[model samples]
Target: MNKIERIGVYTSGGDAPGMNAAIRAVVRTALYNGIKVTGIYRGYEGMIEGDFKEMVSRSVSSILQKGGTILKSARCAEFRTPEGRQKAYDQVKAAGIDALVAIGGDGTFTGAELFSKEFDIPVMCIPGTIDNDLYGSDYTLGFDTANNTVIDAIDKIKDTAASHNRLFFVEVMGRDSGCIALNAGVAGGAEALMLPEKDTAIEELIDSLEEARERNKTSMIVIVAEGDKNGGAYNVAKRVKEKFDFYDTKVSILGHLQRGGSPSSFDRVLATRMGYFAVNELIRGNRSATVGIRGSQIVSTSLEEALRGKELKLDEELLKIAQVMNI
Candidate 1:
């Protein structure tokens, strides 16, 4: 680990817009230090099948603005098996890999930790999920871009809501976390925000819509996370309509739309910073740790600390702002 000779990089889970930016940073920085880089295609599945290619400085050139992982990504539950993990380790040894860089979220980081522990090799993780659910880092690599995407869609939906004087329910991607929904709700000036962390006050929500009506408000927008306990948006909308006797409610599930598009200026910068710092950490002999941006500093803790399933807490200040703006 003194001098990185060859490093392998892989991405797992859903593809994020800023993934290529992270891969580019890792390759460019590693090559700058005279290290060989190998791209693991389709995640660890590619590792077992030997579906990898040598990555050069030119391989990732001009990919900073790209929207997907250059190495691609996947879920290889097979890799969890001892035989499968052994195959991956054997492949790495055969390919002369000195270190590994894994760009992904909680599940992916846990797998990287397991691989590193078994092989006793350095593994660095760059958080790349749009969910922004990963703990430790204030922001994941693709979050800014996804937030921008979510708010952009919300803005467009606003025009239609105002045109028809209707209530619009906009559901965003947040499997078990609501950082995306909560942040976008505040930014988009949504009336009520629903997240997995808290229960939605349907009675209060109905009263708010009634109040908006009494005040001659033309439109109301509710931002609900996909993981919200109330169920999918359509079911919630139906319940709202039935209980409140309100019709003409529009449902707009942002779905994977928020995960597409080019990496924004903020996401690109964050990814590059994380990627370069991760390589440096491995050079310093760090293993079983996930490099994360903690309070504007690149500090990392044990992957064990990361796997505790801690979720990002909502910023109450932003919630306050959202409430004040709605008033």
Candidate 2:
């Protein structure tokens, strides 16, 4: 492989907490290795439009605690086309970027994988989604911070639920994964959880609520993932109300609030590690991969494997624990 002279870094897809930390690591690590870094604004759209900026160590300074990304992010329909990709390649060559470090989730990786194969430019990915649904990484960036945000809301909501003896169906931002809902639900001591991985029936949910009432529980909470088959928290709460009116029902959709917050220590460290490794891996000539952590160790998986491999499943043990503890 030719010697890498310049690397381009960008964040794409939905914004996640700790992305700036990852960007900081990528810029500083590349500079430390004597390679120039270009910040690609607005992801693929910027790549095609030549919205590039020279990145220095000072450019990323003091952004570690920041939420969202310094590079910004966007979904580019234009990037999915051959013509658009060709334009992006021209811009990348014009900017003299020899390699790339992409930050985001599956859509980001898919684009990176295609862009690398088409243009033969080395690319590495960092898992920066809060969903934690990506296959390669055990934990994605912002997952911890999102969970913390949800738990904080749950704690505060619980206060009102207790005061009114209400049943709160709190929805979190896991559209396809239950990592956020399950983890936060358990941590917040919710009475039940409706996850995407599990097709929880309305009858079963009512049973849980009825059981809670029988146990003389003053207030109950049912955490729901956004992708729950029963529709969102509002729909589930509506169905539950039709049958069981034991307590006043309410719905709290966390919405985009989960996507914004100063990253937790774990996420900051994880993003930094992933970002540092992504640059080093590209320098080492191991291209087209995603950086991830498995049990405290940072590892790289090929893009093909990371994108095509079986998705990480919800832990059955954790599911059982959530159920047992809810009692």
Candidate 3:
């Protein structure tokens, strides 16, 4: 049980909405507990470069509603090497940073787990990805906000598709998980969904479209996860057009738009809770764990346990509901 004094926090990997909110919560919570906080910019890159700023309660003011992270995020290929990690540790020791709080997805947790073990530093993680792919947490920090963004775009596309009598293929993020696609599909009433978790063939998609056509669906939208086997929205739309093109076909790649926006009521509150929980965990001598929400309760899991085999979050019941709703 290391007596953690000064703790450093950073956001890593891809940027997501509600990240700023998490940052705010972390900074304020640490300050409230009479702990010193340092903001690590650009993730591991910043740690290695010694790019740090002392953070206080006012440092995070008016940032709760902002999109993206104030600390920012970036991939650090250098951090993958022993030499780079050694340099980061040197910086941490020099700066008097005794512990760490990382906010990101799987890659972020993997790095934290390794760093904590090697340096024997107390660390905690906040699941701050829009993908919601992590297992321990019921919902990641930015997932709800990203879902809202996707449904907003889908609703607008639905209006245009209805007016033009078109079949729209909308692609959402999630290269490894389908949490965004599945939730957004059910919410948007998509005609079909192609997820990375499930192999959805073009022929099967055509058949589903054919059924929709028979049911006289004037305007149809199909949600495709970015990692779908048949490429992305454009390639899927092309394949579907070659086989069955009942209505004019179009493709819309939502791209990073789903990664931005003011987080919803759910995400802001969730981020705040997770951030506060993470700081407390570190102060209690807990190390190398991630803060997660089970049902209504906030919980902590060792990073080693949290980073176990990839979590398949696609809900079977949700898929059935999506199918029934489409019909």
Best by TM-score: 2
lDDT values for all models: 0.85, 0.94, 0.91
TM-score of structure candidate 3 = 0.98
Give TM per candidate.
Answer: 0.96, 0.99, 0.98
Question: Per-residue CA lDDT of candidate 2, range 1-327, in tens?
Answer: 999999999999999999999999999999999999999999999999999999999999999999998888899999999999999999999999999999999999999999999999999999999999888778999999999999999999999999999999999988889999999998999999999988999999999888889989989999999999999999999999999998989999889999998999999999899989998998899979999998989999999999999867898888889889977
How well is each residue in 182-258 modelled by candidate 1, as lDDT tens digits?
Answer: 89998898988888888876777787778767877778899989988989688778878987655479899888878
Q: Which of the two, 1 or 2, has more lDDT?
A: 2
Instruction: Output the worst ten-in-a-row residue range by lDDT, candidate 1.
Output: 303-312
RMSD of candidate 3 to true structure, Å: 1.0
> At residue 233, what lDDT does model 2 achieve?
95
**Total clashing pairs for each candidate:** 0, 0, 0
> Would you give me the overall lDDT of model 3?
0.91
The list of candidate 2 runs beyond 4 A from truth reads none
Cα error, residue 140 of model 2, in Å, equals 0.5
Candidate achieving higher TM-score, 1 or 3: 3
- Candidate 2 at 255: error in angstroms? 0.6
- Pick the winner on lDDT between candidates 2 and 3: 2
Model 3 ranges with Cα > 4 A deviation: none
